[model samples]
Target: MQVQFGVLGPVVAWDGAGDAIALKGPRHRAVLARLIIARRRVVPVFRLVEDLWTDPPADAVGAVRTFVAALRRALEPERPPRAPARLLLTEGPGYALRAEPGAVDAWRFEQAVAATATLPPKEVFARLEEALGWWRGPAYAEFADQPWVRAERSRLAELRLHAVERQAEARLGLGLAAEAVPDLDAHVAEHPWREDAWRLLALALYRTGRQGDALAVLRRARTLLVEQLGVDPGPGLRGLEADILGHAAHLAPAPGPGGAAGRVWAQTAAAYDRTVPSGARVRLESTVGLLRNLAVTGGSGLQAARRHRVAAVAAAEELGDAELTARVIGVYDVPAIWTRVDDPEQAAQVVAAAERTLTALPPGGHEAARARLLATIALESRGPLPQARRAGRTPSARGPQAARQAEEIARRLDDAALLAFALNAVFMQTFHRAGLAPRRDEIGVELVALSARHGLATSEVLGHLIRLQARSALADFPGADHHATAADRLAERHELPLVGVFTQWYAALRTAATGPAAAAEAEAAYRNAAARLDGAGMPGLEHGLLPLALLCLRVQHAQPAQAEEHTDWGPYEPWARPLALLAQDRRSEAAAALRKVPDPPHDLLFEALWCLTAQAAIAVGDRQTMERAYIQLTPAAAELAGAGSGLLTLGPVSKHLSDLATALRRPR
Candidate 1:
């Protein structure tokens, strides 16, 4: 006999004739929902009573047993007297509900979702809709607040989200991108933290020709990441933005509503696969191409890269050439830095593995490439641009040297992409490991020229970003603002989502550096920048943004929602945590907290950090702490002595250390 049970929403049951069973009221419904949540496993009567009732009666166990009897009567109303209940079984100390696979809506929903896994595009779309149909409103809406039910609902919601993501992919794959937009929009609204959903949404927008809205969503996501999480955007999202900016051939749509042709990139993959000659060389080349496409194509970069890395290794082994394999490995090396599962502290393990793998490699392309790979890992581990730059001057710093090799090889091979990558390496070096960004105006100009010639939007945006920071540190106000404006404009115009958000942030930092007169304006701008930081991957926004950050602190008006963003700053928590307390009018506590924030070694933000401590201490009547902070400022006094006004716009690198030093040490 067919019995359809749906506990995913309200509890509903019907036998083969589709007639609703006369299940009693709320208690009966609660019993059914709770049992379904337990997935037919034996749930003890005492536990069920605790979870189902906020205030349990003295006879709770007997009450639950009565509810189970009502449930059994409802499940099989016509069962003969003394006939063992088929659906509800009384096990030791508890009861269980057992139904066929398709009987329960929640089980059917999962089954439908699992069925979509290996289906073709058309089938996937149909199955996804079927799975989505089970959600009548949150799973078990009546029991939404029940602690036991909450976990199940959360799991189902997450499952539903995954289903939505997959459904959107199917829609996009079939060239039905516009159809997926509504669901993705809702998905992101409900769950802003899932960057992949944002990525897919942005892509759908781009594919449907809504460039500005696409940029806005990316910016919005950035803001959430920054103001709410104090972090930068993920690489997959960044890569998507870059591709959008450059109008990457791969992202361009295949004509039609059904997406029967899929994305242009898919066509390229097929074409490339066909071009390779059948041999070990073919295998090696195909793997390399797949790695690049996966890395650049947005979404699933790491998983695809890992899979192909092994394939490349197998082909290299078959060909009997270690150098060839090392070169292949080199091509795929940067993925570790950008992988979705990346752990900043875990790079040393990867470095050790790479070193062992390449130790026997001859002094050729492989050795240099491995060194460059290590450099990327080192930079990635430090977290963000400035800190990474400062951290790179260690005894183990080899990225710069290896990058030089890549530059030479690219020049020899006349490869534009590799040359661009190598130029980026040079640019990375200009952040000046000493703490402040040193003068690198020449490299900025060169980057501008290189990136423009090759149509590299990411490079162009970065080039301008570098110029903007350098100009600010040099106290070139008009020039700094000009660079800032240019970067901000380009970031908006191009698909440089991260760069766009960063320009907005750094531009505000520049404004804040203009001093007291600009604080209010800069404060507003800083808030705007925070909103756009999700895609701004490089980090170090805190330094230049400090002036306005202080304004927010001083006024005791900083928003907790925004302050929550920096909670994961780890060791740098003190640098930002006091601002949170200050926002809540906890002055004395903030002052106490500031005293504990130590100056990191080789710290570029050293002067600014101390000055902030001094300012914060003054607010809370901590004269001794203020004096100690001012004393710490003395070391950088001479460096900024000759510098003009507005060093606050200067970053944590050597470039602006003098400006910050000069200003902090000025007579009271």
Candidate 2:
């Protein structure tokens, strides 16, 4: 059987079947309520006696004992004569209530509100609404005049109010400012001292085009604070007031779902579904390409994408149209930088399709289409399949060969988009190795110049993102931040929401690198970024990316890295596990583990893995691994380790290299 308690309204208890436990009299109810407010802590019998009454009779202690007995009988009706109470237990000199999680409505309500910090607007609003529903009325309403319950009651009331404000904040985030206005108006009117509520009400009014009303609300707030509280309005309220007067551009509502580009793609997909036939070979082929690109970048479901890919490839093959096949294969959407191919099986299918088309075309003909297919092969082949890795299959040079052929053809064609495409393929092949930031930097430069000249918005965003990663790796904070800003602006303009995702990650990385003063803030920032990434539905890009970054941050701060280590880091587990072991002070275990791990793979995360290894080696005093890591990391000695991921870093590579040298008895 189960039991539940509620003090959100009058003190009450319900058994497993929802029948209210008859807490006999006022004194019995008071005792039960006091015990509930103890929050599982032991409440001394003497303290309860003083709180229950101002005056005592000769048998007052006996009276207290009788009240406890009655309460136990009501709360635990099934207890045998000799059995002790399960929910309420007597300990030492007091009694404690052992309610489970969610048994108490007040506790459950608080937890729900606390969890909304990192959620998206829609989720935040839903959760906050659920939390507020737990409040039946004033907390401990039956004991409003009692001094004993005063503090707890006040605390819960304030928490409920704060939840209301948080919900309104979420509403504003969801662009529902108009809907938020009514409740906020009531909230501020009833609690005029709450500047946050006032600010939200004003902002909501302003968003709803009531600028004069918004300004008036702020003015009223200022007057209330100055006259009653004897302080000017806080920074937030004052700042909002100033922004309203100036009509700041940022105050406008955010762009609707997916911005302009997303709406267009959605409309197009809908129109195609409504009117286009599967037998329209050419149109279907183009639609399939667009769907595949969306699947990679985001805004498309995986099963649907796979279905489209299969159907389109089959249709093109059945028709024996090489051009349509090439179109389908060549148009795989290039995702944001650092987004490795997650569905390698799908990639292999595309490669097979391209090869079949290549065989159909004459050796010297279809150069443009051939170049695109070759670049696709190069990009897709860069990340080896998990099954191949498990089988210990050595990588072939096919990726590089295809990339080179693509680049040669693109250069001959004198097409900027084609050249940029080939360069991206080359980037995929080369970027996985450690100490290759300089090469990557050169590619980034060419990408930016060429893409900007041709006004390739997607490519331009990609260029800035690549440059941001390279610059961060090369220890140029200013350059990295500059590119990050540019990438953010370009992504917003182009409706590339995922681009902003990476840029936000870069901001967190910068915060984490700012040292101990920002450690807590940095952790919060990383958590929020991870939440946003998850919410965006880009799981492939999110997997292990933030966890690796967090591990790097914790390692630098000399904090406990055990929590981060326990996360399911997928392929990066080998690099992160040893560091976590060292963090727990298991030095010999860390050293042995490091010895068993393979050399870090040459991929986008190569530098990150090596740098993590370098940290573990330093801690475990594994001089040999130190020397190996040193050799790989020394080339980019001035750079910050792991910045290529745009999420987190393990301080500077130079710092680790210097330490490795010192340990190795060599000069820096």
Candidate 3:
């Protein structure tokens, strides 16, 4: 018979035979409760005695044994005839109760709460509803006065409140706001001091087109706060009031036939459209505000619209009006996306919206003046040719007439900081694309020249440029050492994460250039960077760059198993798997896998370099193929030749390339 015990609420013990198993007395109940909660585990006799009697007589152990015997008899009245004594077993200084997980109401409650985490609103609501339904009255009502029971009861009460909140939130999300209102209203009435409940009620009211009522709710909350605690409502509640007041005409709650939550959601969407871009500072402030607000509130309408609103507001602010603020805000958005939202599609959409807004802004008004804004937006967009063209456009220029616009902007922006920013953005976009290494190098030289002229030696812009140079070296480009050394110096001097990334890149390149032993120090540096920065919420730079460097080390070590464990199969999977396969001596399979990798145009140069190197290493006997591979890498090599102090791997990679050249020249 399946029996469930829920004395934690009302004493309810029912079996499949439809008979109530009498659970009587506080001590007897405590014995059963302790045994059930610690089911299949031993509760030492001394521990049980200690729990039952905070200050016990000398015969505490003997008294505990008597209670246990009494509990055994009560649990199995007809056991003497034939039933085994398997329900409770004696263990070393303890007792164990044999029962399934659902046998205890507390266990069931925990299970329900855990199950609701990944489920949709309807499902979560159902589970929580079932769990909450089991509560007939105050938990352990008979023993509420007891210390142990009081603590347990308080814990259950808190869990119940949490479940109720989750259930209300789910109902709101599922467009059942009206149905949730009554329960939520009762909850608010029960605990009038609970701000979250009040907030939920206001949200529901607003959604139902009860804008006046919603405002009234806030006013009531304000009054309640003053009356109860002698303080005004907090920022979140006040902000809701401000939103309603500021956009009253637009927020008139729809008359209810459907759910009020849905209406509220639609209203919020409309509000987002209206208030997002008042000005640069306002937009930035609003975007940052919304992101933070949603994190704390955890409701539907306003929170749901937060990402889109933030993106739109950011976009509107970047329209050549407030360049520095917009750029700073734009950079801040990258980390915010990952930390704030679980939905990748929604996060990506926010970024895309910001990029589109940035792109639509008028260009060439004062490239030098707007250099920071232009550079930040260009980098965020991740497309060099388009950004370069946009940078060139002026009110008077048309067609090829504005071809020199980028250079003009760079020249006019004589500020070293601004020019360096633009160049780094350009370099990032170029290097990210497959075949653009040569172009990246060419542009990089120009940036270096600009840096030299303007004395922009210590900044994030220089860090970015140096990191790119290190990447080129890893791809076996010439003169990578210069960039690597510069990046190292800058990183050491400034103590920045970007420098740490460059250091790893340099270490990896040095390893690849020299031998496995040369890479040990580099590997240690990469590990340190990964530990320090991977999840630390740093923005704009590649957080995964350290992981890539680690993978490079795995290739050097030929540890396929370790590589498989650490490497993620997303962006770097294509390169990672092939590298792993080559390491494992699966040459043909590695080459075949490399062929399937997407050939994004900009990524071609680095891709070709790595692919050719891997192919040559695997097909050591094939001189002709090695020669062909070497020829494909020449353009990238030449591009790296002029690279300066920023290149870290040039020395090691150059050596590897020389060895490959020597191998190719030998008789086949």
Candidate 4:
């Protein structure tokens, strides 16, 4: 007869047919519970004697043996007389209860919780929810008062708390931070000393945009720790507080539906695998090729997309089709950064791969594949053009040539997606030069129309985003806000969470531009946006962006600039350092530094730096540098500074041009 033990709630046993096994009395149940807690290990008769009674009775040993016999008969009613008991076996000193898998609820619950560790957030949450459901009340509930069960009960309770906290973490990972708040609130209330619980609750509140409430939760946690535990909160809580204060980007949920999209891709991949005919290499190659493009724009993690790229490239090469190989290679996995160069090594590899694939294909016939390769090459190689130009070197036209060719081919092919991609490449190449807002606005219009017509979610988001930047740079806040609203709505609807980061930062920049009164609020917004970026784990995206924003605000609003606040200015260091020095009243040093600062690189950052330089030169009475900055910034005078990224802005360029006109005695 099969038997299932239940110690998670009450110390009870049920037979194979779901009938209750009579446990006789409290002492009888205690003996069985003691054996179960020993985990199938032999418990000496003497130990059982001590466990059953605080003071051993004269026939305590005999009483234990009788109880064990009763348990064996009840647990295995079909056992023949004198037959060795299977469920309860007699050892040399005492006995052991043999429990099989799923026979013990407590053991099964523990196993389920352990299995959730490697799973992604959604699966982890699901598995943990199921595991936690196995707990009826508590471990060994009816045996709760027994001295032998005390330690085990406490351990099980702690495990339950851990499971609760992990589930909350999974919720946060799934972008359900608001949903995690109430449970975490109840959890921390129940377990006041659990710092992790308090931290999670605070984080949830922060994600929901309740900054004050989040900080209050942390404060309450600190008070509890100091009052109850007589110690400070641990490093995790402290670090989280600092991260929250700074608006660290890592705290934000992933920008897109990476987890959800991964799940969808997994299902689609399985379907393809199931339908593919066995030994059909060409079909397999075709399947891989189709999946490769999906993975690139699937909003999944980079590693997953890279895996698909590798597999697709390998399959394409195996088929020995040059056009197919080039197409596969052309669909790069890395997300493009428009504001600045981030990953040079990966970009270089992509350019080299595309070039080599293009060389392998017959030049004339593979127009679609060739266009894709050209666009990818342009995107990867466009970064250094501005720097080369700044060094008085005639910049290579290869990148621009590729972007033009890709766009031309895409237009002829009548493929909207292809044209959108090629236009994106053209945008990347042209964005390196300053004073191109009008041109960028034109591209934005076409991308929006094309992507909307094709129902391409990602490309449509990109379109609205580009329009937002161009509008902001043109000093059209209402137009910028319109596109920002559109982009944000699309982002949420399509699971592109990262779009909010840019929109939020622009909100801050707009706030700062409202004048000096809004500086503090704007600063907080920037820090929060930075935190979101950090949470997204894309470091280069936020690099120097914050400092530049702060500096722009300070200089524009005539606020006192603190040089020490910007310890790391990243790529803007050379251009921004002198301005910071000049702000500190170091005229000679500022002028010398200004002289060393070369003609500004023509990139997204160019107009902002030029305006900053003009401000610093005005302060130092350096007409030579002022005139230089004036000439460079003149064409962009009608534009807004640093608004090309749809992220940050430094007010209008005309404002800086006005300052230069008054200082250098130059007519504007």
All models, RMSD in angstroms: 17.4, 15.1, 16.8, 23.1
Residue 163 of candidate 1: its Cα lDDT? 88
Lowest lDDT block of 10, candidate 1: 333-342
- Deviation from native of the Cα of residue 380 in model 3, angstroms: 3.3
Runs of candidate 4 with Cα error greater than 4 angstroms are 1-268, 271-300, 303-321, 332-337, 385-396
Q: How far is candidate 2 from the true structure (C-alpha RMSD, Å)?
A: 15.1
TM-score of each: 0.50, 0.60, 0.45, 0.58
Output the number of the TM-score-best candidate. 2
Q: Which of candidates 2 and 3 reaches a greater lDDT? A: 2
TM-score of 1: 0.50
Whole-model lDDT, candidate 4?
Answer: 0.77
lDDT of every model, 2 decimals:
0.61, 0.80, 0.55, 0.77
Q: Measured by C-alpha RMSD in angstroms, how accurate is candidate 1? A: 17.4
Sliding window of 10 residues with minimal summed lDDT for model 3 = 332-341
List the candidates ranked by lDDT, beginning with the highest. Answer: 2, 4, 1, 3
lDDT of 3: 0.55
Output the number of the lDDT-best candidate.
Answer: 2
lDDT of 1 by residue, 5-41 (tens): 8866777888887778777888888888877777879
